[model samples]
Structure formats: C-alpha cells, structure tokens
Target chain A: MTHTDNGFSATRRLILQGASAVVLVGLGNLPFGLAPAFAAANDKYPEEAFKAKSEADAIKALYGKTPEASDKVKMDAPEIAENGAVVPVSVTTTLPDVTSISFLVAENPVALVASYKIPAGTMPSVANRIKMAKTSNVIVVVEAGGKLYSATKEVKVTVGGCGG
Target chain B: MASTIRVRATSSGETTEVQALIQHPMDSGFVKDAKGEIIPPHFIQQLTFEYDGKPVFTADWGGGVSKDPYVKFAFKGGKKGDELKVSWTDNKGASDTTTAKIQ
Candidate 1:
C-alpha cells in the first residue's frame, strides 16, 4: 500500500511539472505575439503602396524621376527562362563618365532592386541573378557623369518564382 | 556582408574580359516555411558594371532564375590597371555594390 501511494504521488508531481512548463512557454510567447502589434503601431507608411507594377514604376520610385532609355546599356537575359527561381543575367554598358549602376524588376513589390556607386577610376560592369515572381521586364539604370541612362528586357517566368 | 567577390579579367590584345562571382542566398520567395507556407519571392533584379568612369555592361533579371546567379561577359579596350565595379539590387529593395580591380 505504501509503495503504491509513493508511485501515485510521483506521477502527480510529474504531471504538475509538465503543466507548469507549458504555462511558462505560453507566457514566453505572449511578448512575441504582441511584437507585430507594436510594429504596426509604429509604421507610418503603407509600405506595400511603394511596390512597382512594372520596371518603369520601380525606376521612378528609385530616383524620384524618370530615366532616359539608352542603347548604351546592354541587358543580357534568356528569352525564355526554364526555371522561374534562378535566371542568369548579365549587364554591360559602354556609356562614358559612368558613376553609378542600378537594376530593377517591374512586376515586383518595391522594384528598385539593387544599386552600385562606382568609385572614380573603376571599371563599370556588373552581373547577377534576379528572381521573378512572374513574367516581367527587367530594367537597368546607369548614372554616368551625373546623367541617368536606362534599358529594359522582357523575361518570361514560366514557372512561378513566387509560390502560387 | 563582408563577402568575398572573385573577379577575373582576361586580356587578349586590346580587348579585356571580366568575370565575377558573389556569395548571396538569392532567396526565392516561392520556397516554403517549416509549416509549408509559401515564402514570398525575394531576388536580385539588376546589376551593372563600370570601368574607369565608363559603363561597360548592365543586366536586368527576373524571378525565372536561380539563386546566386553567375554572370560572365567581355568588353573591348580594357587595360590591366582598370577598376571593375559591380553592383546589384533585389526585389525587396535591398542593394549591394562591390568593386574589383582588373588584374
């Protein structure tokens, strides 16, 4: 009888301990749950409103003005991308007095993709891969000698790069 | 951040060729989270190369690509002492640009 009572008490204690641990974890998560609310309170702008519907929109948002289309910017990409996740891209330019380079995706949220400030006496060239949520035009903008020149290329995203 | 970008420039007579590689996750938002929810797409969309205050190349990209996209190209009239600057931007509005000297 004594042994049976001891076993029962030990089991009860174990259950209580488990319950307390669960309560502690729940309390710990409460702060995390409130974090989003705090973030929303601090947000002043509708961040999604800045998303670009096309490559043009992205450029406008980036420089606060329109960029002139120029042949000097060479945008190399596959006409048809087999995979929507990884597309190889290369951009070369022969523009003189180049000071900066940038890239943008037209159909993405907040399209002004990347920018590079070229130091004096450096070669102006860049290559990289970009993800597409869907089929869209890729745009390149170059700030050369204080003037901005741009180019665009249409890329077809057959498979959804963003989960559909 | 503080990642190494490998740059190689080859010269044949007057023409100079350049190649570069950067370490980036190139995360595609279509991936799933641990709970199987589709993660939003994030990717690099633009890149540019400049040599000695001259724009040599520029590229535009989209989602139908893979992670850590590798790029290679050639240009005419690059010298051995030229500076090659590379920069990129992503869909999330994040940007990074780095420079490599032609060797």
Candidate 2:
C-alpha cells in the first residue's frame, strides 16, 4: 500500500487548468474576465448532481439536458444480482465523439451513481461497480458529439445494497 | 500511511487499458449500524487518471458506488514503461495519488 502526496502536487495544475474542456460544447462565448471562473465551474465536483435523488433531476443537474434513447449505447449487467452491494455493470458505445459517460440507479438513494469525463484520445467505454437498493432499472448515458443518448436495463436485486 | 489506490495500466501497442481499485467506505448515509444508528456519508467524489500530464479519464462518483470501488477504461497512445497517475478525492477532503507504469 505505498502512497505519496507527490501525485497530488504534480497534477494540481492540470486539475485546476481543468479538463471541463469537454463541457465547453455549448458555452458559446468565453469572455476574458470570466474565463478562469467558467473553467473552474466545469471542473469542480458536481455536488448538486450527485445529490439529486431522482434520475431525471440527477441527469439534468449533471448534463443540464435530456437524453434520447439510442441503440448505439450498449450496457452489460446481470439480469439478477444476488448481492446488491456490489453489482457489476459496464457500458460501451459505438457513438462517435463521445465526451462523457454516466450511470444511474433509479432506486438508489442518490440516483446518480457515477459520471465520467472522457477526454479526447480516450475510448468511449467504462466498467464499474454500483450499489442497487432494490430491483430497478440502471440507466447509462453517453454524451457524444455534444448530444446525450441513453440506454437502460432492469437489474433484480435479491438483497438491497443500502441496507434499507 | 499507505496509498488507497491500486492501478494496472497495460499498453497493447496502440491503446492502453487501465484498471483501478480504490479503498473507501462509500457510505451513502442511508445505512444503519448494529445499534440502529445511521452511518454518515463518506465516499470518493472524484477520481482521475493522467498520462503525459494530461487527464485521460475523470470520474465523479457518489455514495451509490460500492465499497472499495473498481473501475476500468482504456486510452490511446500510451507506450510501455510510460507512467500513469491515478488520484482520488473524497467528500471528506481526503485524497491520495499513486503513479503506475504501463506494462
């Protein structure tokens, strides 16, 4: 378990320079005075989005837009999860110019499980483990070419992950 | 005093696939304890992977993530022996960063 503060100090500039560059898709204008502030806003942890209890509100807060159903998005997950505490889920997309990917559990206390920012040169695919409170649909959203597209699948949980 | 992040980055000539497993409670604040007391929320809020000083992947996570989170992804153009930096910051302001070599 070796660790160091070295990585944090070195990457500080890069994080502050902020890769919210992907979200710059629709800001339209960037004034000199507000440039720094705007960039910071893009990189900051999306507190509100993660706090949203409903799937719709979480997506709106995270992307500020609605997604259309897309066949291009492919999601893989078990039809039944015996342990809701750790459900394996993965999403991959054939959509071009994808900028981000997000996963949401409609029945979880916080609907938004995770949102990933995809920088250029990175593949538009991700795999992660999420908690499910009950039998519910898991939605995966992919933001490609400045538009949002989504796909969902229902996962039956034998045990609730939140211990609810 | 150990790093909570473990990462494996492998390059297959053209693209590098990265898999990371992090240690954290990821408590959603909705769970109860043996005494029926609610466990307060504590979870990693953001995780980033960088190569050549550029961020290739960034994840914004919530309490819904499982304990000791694991994530996998890939990026183009990383060569063997090159370095990849993985770091994470939690809701409580605790963070750790580790450097792994692409194999």
Report the number of the highest-DockQ candidate. Answer: 2
Predicted model 1 interface RMSD: 6.9
* Chain A TM-score from candidate 2: 0.76
Worst 10 residues of 1 chain B by lDDT: B58-67
In model 2, the Cα lDDT at residue A67 comes to 98
* Model 2 per-residue lDDT tens digits across residues B62-103: 999999999999999999999999999998999999999999
Compared with the true structure, what per-residue lDDT tens digits does model 2 show for residues A1-164? Answer: 13456777668767755656534733544455376665466578999998899999999998899999999999999999999999999999999999999999998888999999998899999999999999999999999999999999999999999976
RMSD of each: 16.1, 13.2
Question: In model 1, what is the error at residue B87, expressed in angstroms?
Answer: 12
lDDT tens digits by residue: candidate 1, B13-50:
56677777756555555468789886676656666677
Ten-residue region with minimum lDDT total, candidate 2 chain A: A21-30
Error of 1 at A8 (Å): 80
Report residue A110 deviation for candidate 1 (angstroms).
3.8
Worst 10 residues of 1 chain A by lDDT: A41-50
